[model samples]
Target: MRNYFIDLLTKEAESNNKIMLMVGDLGFSVVENFKEKYPKQFINAGVAEQNMTGMAAGLASEKFHVFTYSIANFNTFRCSEQIRNDIDYHNYNVTVVSVGGGLSYGALGYSHHAIQDYALMRSFPNMTIYAPGTRSEITNCMKQIFKSKSPAYLRLGKTLPKNFKKLYKPNHCAPGKWTKILECKNPDSRKCILTTGAVIDDAVQMQKKEEFSNYHIYSLPIWGMQYKTLQAKQINKWDEIVTLEDHLEDGGFGSYILECNSNIKTAGETKIKLKSLNKNVCNTVGDQDNLKEHFKFAH
Candidate 1:
């Protein structure tokens, strides 16, 4: 996901001089290509995440589309004040790029865990959340963020499959719209699993199981506060919707989905089930797969 982001950003920067990238003293091997190609547009902001975020906001104020890149926690939690006051508050065109979303960096311990990132980013009024589930989705997400002029969050995993089959056409995605990935055999089956990030793989695997064979699968790569109305229109199409996410249940994708329906009088009939990582793995230190097992998210 990181590689794809840099490749796309580098290509976009060639045509659009306003695209700038700032990092918090990280992304060594992965970011050098962009730095070498567009030296003037790239900045290594040392270890000060707060300053980097502020700089991104400052640059965006000058009509530059700035992207602040770092590990999930450092980019979001460590510099949250700057993100809120300088970026989202002003509706700057700054994309907070967070690699290693969810438990992707679990081996590094709790400090690197991004389980609560959605809860934090979603609270900001002008923030747009881009949680892509596959390489195709990542490509679409990058294109959307590049074109969007608002403050956005791009959540990515540390590693991803390169040759996996694409679930949805990348160009068909739009903010708050759900893309149907796997259709159930019976057209009458209205139960589906809706996922927003790397958890889409788990939902696909679950659908292949005999017990869940009748369930469909969908991925929502883009969503946020302003897009709640779009979700309300889609919720009535499904009788039972299972929302899956790597983050904790509280304030995660499922919570957002429920919030979208809370104000609609007719939405109470839909059964929404949230399947998220259990808090038991909050303190565990292991690889991504190991931590997922501890949280009962393993396939």
Candidate 2:
């Protein structure tokens, strides 16, 4: 996912001179391509995440589309104030790029876990949450991010499978929209699995079980506070909606979805289920797969 981000940014920077990238003294081997290609547009902030975020905001104020990159926790929790005041508050065109989201850096311990990142970022009124579930979603999300001049949080895993089943029918994505991955043939089928970020893989695997054959699968790669109003209409169409995410249950994708439909009368009767990582996983130390097993999210 990090490689895809850099490659896409490098390509986009060729024509978009406003595109600038800053790092918190990380992304050594992976970011070199962009650094070498566009030296003037790249900067190493030397471990100062707060300052890096502020710098990105300053650059955005100057009409540059800046991207601040670092490990998930460093780029978010460590510099949240700057992100809120400097970038999100002012509606700057700065994308906070967080690599190793969720427990991707589990081997490094709880300090690096990004399980609560969505809880933090979504609170910002102007922030767009881009949690791509597939390689194609990553590409589509980046394209949309570049085209819009708004504050965004791009959460990425440390590594991703080289190939997977293509979920999006047209292989494209849009903000506040859910792409149909697998469609149910039964017209009466109303239960479906909706996911954001890499958990889409788990949802896909779950759909193959005999008990879940009637369930369809969908992935929502981009969404946030501004897009909440769009949810009620979609939710109205389903009798049962199961949301999955790598983050904790509280304030995660499922919570956000429920919040969106909280006021609707029919929402009371709709079966809304949430499948997220157990908070207990926070104390464990292992790779992503190991952590998933600990949380019982692995299939």
Predicted model with the maximum lDDT: 1
TM-score of 2: 0.95
How well is each residue in 186-239 modelled by candidate 1, as lDDT tens digits?
A: 768989889898776678777888867888988898999988889977988888
Model 2 global lDDT (CA atoms, 0 to 1) = 0.87
Please list the residue runs of candidate 1 whose C-alpha ends up more than 4 Å from where it truly belongs after superposition: 161-163
- Candidate 1 Cα deviation (angstroms), residue 244: 0.4
lDDT tens readout by residue for model 2, 162-187: 33655454457889998877676575
Which consecutive 10 residues in model 2 have the weakest lDDT in total?
A: 161-170
Question: At residue 34, what lDDT does model 2 achieve?
Answer: 93
- Which clashing pairs does model 1 show? none
Q: What is the lDDT of residue 274 in candidate 2?
A: 90
The Cα error of candidate 2 at residue 188, in Å, is 4.6
In TM-score terms, which candidate is top? 1
C-alpha TM-scores of all predictions = 0.96, 0.95
